[model samples]
Target: MTDTFKHHLELLIACVIYGTVGIYMQQLEDMSIGSIIFYRIFFGLTALLFYLSITRNLGQLALKRKKKYLLLLGILYVLQMFSYYSAIR
Candidate 1:
């Protein structure tokens, strides 16, 4: 496949995966919102690490600078996810 086709395919797959998150969350309505968010982040981080290992890009994760900024970004991301899941719940 050409690069354009491959990119589009990846985009489409990502969209499908993202679109199903709400359905999955709804199905797990019995679980606490914090538990749901934790599982989501855990699985997402696992998947990301797996992908990085497979693509031999693990070295890219090394923090060369701006440690404070990275921490801030992570905090923001957690807050965002918490708000998002809370809203959906």
Candidate 2:
């Protein structure tokens, strides 16, 4: 396959995995909902940071220049997540 076709295939696989995440999340019976969400976010963030570090893209993020905007986005994201999980439970 060409590079473009390979990238599209990877993206399609990612979407399928992402779409199935909720089904897997519903299988955790022992843990509280909060614990489940915490682990999900923690591991997701860790994976994202690791990817950025491996690709040397951390510097490209330019957090210093975008600190204020990123902070605002972070707050909104937290609020949205809180509402989502709360509603689901």
Candidate 3:
């Protein structure tokens, strides 16, 4: 398969997985929306960290290029998420 095809397929799968998780999040009736979002992010990060550790890629995070660009992107992502949650509420 071509690299472009594989990348698009991966993006599709990621969207499906994210949609599935969002559906499940709505069923947690006892938790506040904030708590649900917190758990979702915490678990997602934990799983990502575990995967990186197992793959020995955790060390590469410190050596990534364009640190300022990445930091800006991270901040933008957080702001986007906050805006999304606010809109949902």
Q: When superposed on Cα atoms, how far off is each prediction in RMSD? A: 2.1, 3.1, 2.7
Q: Where is model 3 more than 4 Å wrong at Cα? A: 63-72
lDDT of 1 by residue, 1-89 (tens): 99999999999999998768788887898998878878878998999999999999999999999999999998998898788888877
Candidate 2 residues lying further than 4 Å off, grouped into runs, are 52-62, 82-89
Q: Give the clashing pairs for model 2.
A: none
Model 3 has an lDDT value of 0.76
Give the candidate number with the greatest lDDT. Answer: 1
Ten-residue region with minimum lDDT total, candidate 3: 21-30
TM-score of 1: 0.75
The TM-score between candidate 2 and the true structure equals 0.61
How do the candidates rank by TM-score, highest first? 1, 3, 2
TM-score for each model: 0.75, 0.61, 0.68
RMSD (CA, angstroms), candidate 1: 2.1
lDDT of 1 at 74: 88
Give the per-residue lDDT of model 3 (tens digit) for 6-87.
Answer: 9999999999986675566557656776676678679989999999999999986684689898889978876776666555
In order, candidate lDDTs are 0.89, 0.77, 0.76
Which candidate do you rate higher for TM-score, 1 or 3? 1
Q: What is the lDDT of residue 86 in candidate 1?
A: 81
